[model samples]
Target: MAFKYSGSICSDLDKIRVFIDEILDKLNSIIKDQDTMFDLKLILNELVINGVFHGNECNNNKCVRLYLEVIDNIVRIEVEDEGKGIDYDISSYNSAELKCCGRGLIIVNGLSDEFYVKKNKVIAVKRIN
Candidate 1:
């Protein structure tokens, strides 16, 4: 059976760290690789922060949904925020442009085996082989 977990958070950034750790602990029980765990942690952190800060704009009224699943050795993560969403393309973020502030998606896209954005949501997939 596939392991699955779903959680929601407000716009508070402080809660993010705790949430990440909780989710990571659950994932760790199923995923034994240190490298995979580290990468997953990074991916989750970046996506959740973006959802809370950028997507929800630190508005306490808004919420961010986090979904995680492990099936067939593939880890799937989805984060959605209650906001208007963004229009920037991940491909447009050049590493050379270090001064920009929208590099989170760029890093996420690079790290995850497959990732995409839908409205105010980001979906990322990574193989844990």
Candidate 2:
């Protein structure tokens, strides 16, 4: 099955949290457990925040979209934004720390079974094992 969630909001950081929480809730219902949901939730939140704060440069006029898909026993999450893509080293981020926001994408890479990115977008995948 395929489910889609999207938001076009001001680039305000607060709005980023709200929209991500909203999308995470909708996807959690279809997932297997709380752990999975939480993982996906964290990854989703990070991507959304990155898209707004860093990618779009806090342009309130821009928006982002998140797409969820379940296929072949795997869950896929895609985040797309209206802003230009960011070029960061996903590998060199600090993995363990109280403040890991600097390595949000790296943390996401560790949590996801598979991760991919494209211009203006990112995708996180987890196999429901």
Candidate 3:
């Protein structure tokens, strides 16, 4: 079976919760493992938050596009924002120390089996057993 969701949402932090809930609801039947669900939630939150805050600069007029797909026990997540793009070394944030900022990408990278950034879009993949 395959489940997919491709949609766009306003770049507002307040809308993230509802958007995530809707995605989770759609995937509930496919993903039953609690750990995988938690990881997915975290990944979704981090990516969306980053897109809204850093990419779109919290501008509600802008929109964040999201694409989620699950097929053959593999989950693919993509988030795109309406900003220029990111230009930084992702590996530089690989530290165990806890900081207030600059941890979202690290957390997302650690949790995801595959993670990458292309222009204004972030993509992550996870294998659900």
Candidate 4:
């Protein structure tokens, strides 16, 4: 059986991290690897932040959906926002370039085994053995 967890939260910056942490806390029981835990935390943070700030524009009324699923060693994460999606093209940004912001997608793409965007939703997968 696959382990799954999902919830939606308002576009509140302060609350997003807490919600992600709660989900990760539950995932920890299933995933057992120090490196995998760290990578998953980073990936989840990047995606959720984008969903709340960029996608919903910090509008409290709008919500961001967070979803996670783990099957064996493979883990899939999905974040969707209640807003119009942007024209996301990860290929345009050079990963090496230094920037304070707008690097989340770049980071996610590099770390995840698979990454894709559909409308206002971003999905990433990583394998933890």
Q: Can you give the TM-score per candidate against the true fold?
A: 0.94, 0.78, 0.92, 0.91
* Model 1 regions more than 4 Å off: none
- Give candidate 4 misplaced runs (Cα > 4 Å): 95-101
Off by over 4 Å in 2: 6-9, 92-102
**Of the candidates numbered 1 and 2, which has the greater TM-score value?**
1
Instruction: Answer with 1 or 3, whichever has the higher TM-score.
Output: 1
Q: What is the lDDT of candidate 3?
A: 0.88
**All models: lDDT?**
0.88, 0.75, 0.88, 0.87
Q: Candidates 2 and 4: which is better by lDDT? A: 4
- RMSD of candidate 4 to true structure, Å: 1.6
Clashing pairs in 2: 11-60
In the range 1-129, model 3's lDDT, one tens digit per residue, is 698899999987667889888898778777899899999999999999899999999999999999999998899999999999886567677467666466888888889999999889999999996
Question: Tens digit of lDDT per residue, candidate 1, span 13-62?
Answer: 78878888999998888889899999999899999998888888989898
Model 3, residue 120: what's the lDDT? 93
103-124, model 2: which lDDT tens digit per residue?
A: 7777788899998878788899
lDDT of 2 at 44: 77
In terms of TM-score, which candidate is strongest? 1
